[model samples]
Target: MNTYTRTHLAFSMLLSIAGLSLPLGAQAADRMAGKMDTDGDGKVSAAEHAVAAKAMFERMDADKDGYVTAAEMDASHAAMKKDGQATDSPMSSADKIKAVDRDGDGKISATEHEAGSKSMFGKMDGDMDGYVTAAEMEAGHKATMGGKK
Candidate 1:
């Protein structure tokens, strides 16, 4: 292969590996997507999305607007860190908040929230059951903790 082809192949491999390194919580949304999507539907309906979206919207939407601003994202990150939930990991809470705040508005919108949640859930839903049951949670917790319950 030519030099360009070899470099592209190497870069592709690195990108693939980078995608595989997301942390436990980061995959939770994909799992929830399967769960909230009742009737085996390919996509999550507004109602189904709303069920799971409410609590998160409330938490992330610091201003109570129908939207999430970038400031809210920072505030959430600060609060989580203050509660001893901070982490230096690549997929830490702060990282997630910053990543999801697309507009740098300090908060995430329903669409962004849904996408992020689905991504995290997908990683955690080991059984593909469309929801994270107690057993699944236990298993994920165990896996993350080196098999310690």
Candidate 2:
């Protein structure tokens, strides 16, 4: 092949790979939004987000102890990774627990989780429209990750 043709091919391949990687974060956000959009509305209403958060709390409370320890959160993240779900959270499990561990209990109670989820929903709503679209969700995730991937 001519040098110019080879260079063009390499550039095209690089672009293709970059494009594929670029959507991973967006895709992860879309998947999360889809899961929380139980009503098939293509967006997560406040109620839907609450329900999803409750369900998540239940899942994370593996011992049914009404609280999620950092260990539990880590285990949940591990399970998500094992199941092929994207668990690329920027915060560690301990950091997550600390963020919402109201009263400094070193763990997350259901009430705390609910409160945190509510706060997160409010932030992710962006326009204060009482619903979170996929775009908003992606933006929120990015913001939570400090605008990192």
Number of the top candidate by lDDT?
2
Q: List, residue by residue over 42-65, the lDDT tens digit for candidate 1.
A: 545445544655565677577787
- Model 2 Cα lDDT, one tens digit per residue, 16-117: 111111233677667777877898889989999888778778887999999988788778767766886633444456656665665788887888778767
lDDT of each: 0.46, 0.64
Instruction: Give per-model TM-scores.
Output: 0.43, 0.80
Question: How high is the lDDT of residue 48 in model 2?
Answer: 92
What are the per-model numbers of colliding residue pairs?
28, 0
**What's model 1's overall lDDT?**
0.46
The candidate scoring highest on TM-score is 2
Whole-model lDDT for model 2 versus the true structure? 0.64
